[model samples]
Target: MSSYFITGVARGLGFEFVRQLSTNPANTIIGLVRDKTATEKKVSEELSGRKNVHLIQGDMVDYASLKKAVDEIATITGGKLDYVIANAAFLSVWAAFEPFSLLAKEPEKLEKELVDMFTVNVVGNIHLFNLITPLVLKGNGKKIIAISSGLGDQEMAINYELFQNAPYSISKTALDMAVAKFHAEYRKDDVLFMCISPGMVDTGYIDPETALLNDMIGKFMKYAPDFNGPTPIDVAIQRILSVMDKSSVEAGDGGKSLSQFGNKQWL
Candidate 1:
């Protein structure tokens, strides 16, 4: 039986991962969220009959909480973990549609946002990985997946001039690097670490009528005109899981930053 640990399962992609993985009664899915009661309610209301799903409270920015979560997960999974999906991150709406030039005008706010983003998106995941790695090492399936973004792709940014969401993009880039570092260290132990972009998933975060969003969409169209828009969360999660299932250290997937399609094609 495969045991999966996913973070930020209160909503969005994290919840979808648990939903899809729990379809198989053999898979033991453990979700980490900041609010255990709320997530447990969600599971009960939506995924009611799935006895394989479990929830634990943890916050990404809290080292002590993450450590406690690791301890709790070890108890639940018998000190072994098959997979880890680092899906929790900080996304700032204030900086979402602004370029660095505009964001630089408010240096104080920019600094705060950057620090918050990096703290959660990069450092927090690093701590979580380090803490849970022992459990992964003891398991049969040693795979760690970091949910990154296409905005992190330097080539895409340079080519399309996608200049919005500066802080978020920067943090995601750093997160991808962090994942690669983990892969470099753990591939020797047959652990597969990968950073995956789920493409543009429609998680109700985008408003089509917003001018800023339209401008971003225009930039995206220049890159891929056929890009209709973000895929559904369920479809995106399914594609990502498929990519994860097919990837392995022996297959040279370790340390790779891949799209849901299992390559660099973000859209």
Candidate 2:
């Protein structure tokens, strides 16, 4: 039996991860969310009778809440955690569809958005990882996964000239490097730290009728001609778990940023 801790388990891919992982009755699943009562209600409504699942109230941007969460998780899992998935992040709609050139017109708003994204996406995860490393070191699985984005890839951005979502991409790129640095330090202890891209999962965030979204889709098509759209959430989670299961420090997977397909094929 393994113990897994995932953040932002209220909806989207985070919820899907808990849903899939908790299917195994022996697996202890601890989900961190900003609202405990609300997420517990959702879990009860949808994933009924899953006694192994637990929810903790915590916000990624709040260090005190995250610290308390680590203490609570220690009590729940007997001071050991097998897996820690850093999935909580901030995505800015203001910068989603525009390049930095256009976004720079509103300097104040752009600065705020960039700072907010970096705080939650990069700094917050660093705090979470630092707090949870001890528990992970004591556990058997010894794996840490950061959910990153393909848009952070420098080569891909330059090749396709994809300039949208600058703030989010910059934050994720920083997050990847942070994860790599953690891996560099922790690999000696056999803890596998890696970033995995979910590869454009459809979480109902995109409205097909939106002109900007369509324009992004056009850019994607230019990159991958056969790209129909985002993959289903369940399929994406399955592929990610498969990759995670197959990866290990001994196999040289530590410090690497891999896609769900276990390589650089983003979408």
Candidate 3:
């Protein structure tokens, strides 16, 4: 039997992780969402009678909430946690790259964007890891997976013209290095830390107010040419889980950022 804890389980990739992982009766799934009342009914309705799944309250930017959730999880799991998926992130903000450039007139806005992005994407994940490391160290699996993005890749950003969403892109790059740091510190203790890109799965979060949605689609087409659009949530999660199952420190998978295609072809 294995125990799993996933954040941002109210919707999107986090919800999918809960769905797929809960299917196995041998696994116990604990999901963290920002709003308990908001998600309780929906999760109960969708996952009816799935006793393997449990929901708790958490917010990525709020370390106190996460610590409380982890304390509860520790009691429930008896101090053993097989996996901790740092899947919660703040990606709701999108801005053009040029606007956030060094020469931009509005330095305040750029600073605010960077601060917001890093608070949730980088600092939050780090705090989560620190709180949960003890339980992970006690488990046999000892794996930590942070959901990252292909846009964070410096080379890919240039080649694919990923000039939009500068704050988000930059934050993810910082997150990748943080994961590497965690791996370096914990590898000796048999804990593995890594990041994975979900490969543009569409979750219907498009904003019609700004051209960001359409602009992103157009840029994706230019990058992949043959690519149509984002992958289905279920399909993307399945591939992601496959990669997670295959990862190992002995194979040099730890401390690396990977894609759906695994370590060799990072997104």
Candidate 1 displacement at residue 35 in angstroms = 1.1
What's the lDDT of the predicted structure labeled candidate 2?
Answer: 0.93
Put down candidate 3 lDDT per residue, 1-267, tens digits, no spaces.
999999999999999999999999889999999888878888789988898888898888888998999998988888789998889888754454343565256777777878999999999999999999999999978999999988788887787676777888899999999999999999898788999889888787754455556766676787677777778999999999999999989888999999887853442
List candidate 3 segments past 4 Å from native. Answer: 96-106, 207-211, 264-267
User: TM-score of every model?
Assistant: 0.98, 0.98, 0.92
State the lDDT of candidate 1 residue by residue for 99-203, as single tens digits: 889999999999999999999999999999999999999998899999999999999999988999989999999999999999999989999999988999888
**Structure candidate 3, residue pairs in collision:** none
Model 1 superposed RMSD (Cα): 0.8
Candidate 3 Cα deviation (angstroms), residue 133? 0.8
Q: Once superposed on the true structure, which residue ranges of model 1 sit more than 4 Å away at CA?
A: none
lDDT of every model, 2 decimals: 0.93, 0.93, 0.86
TM match of model 3 to true structure: 0.92
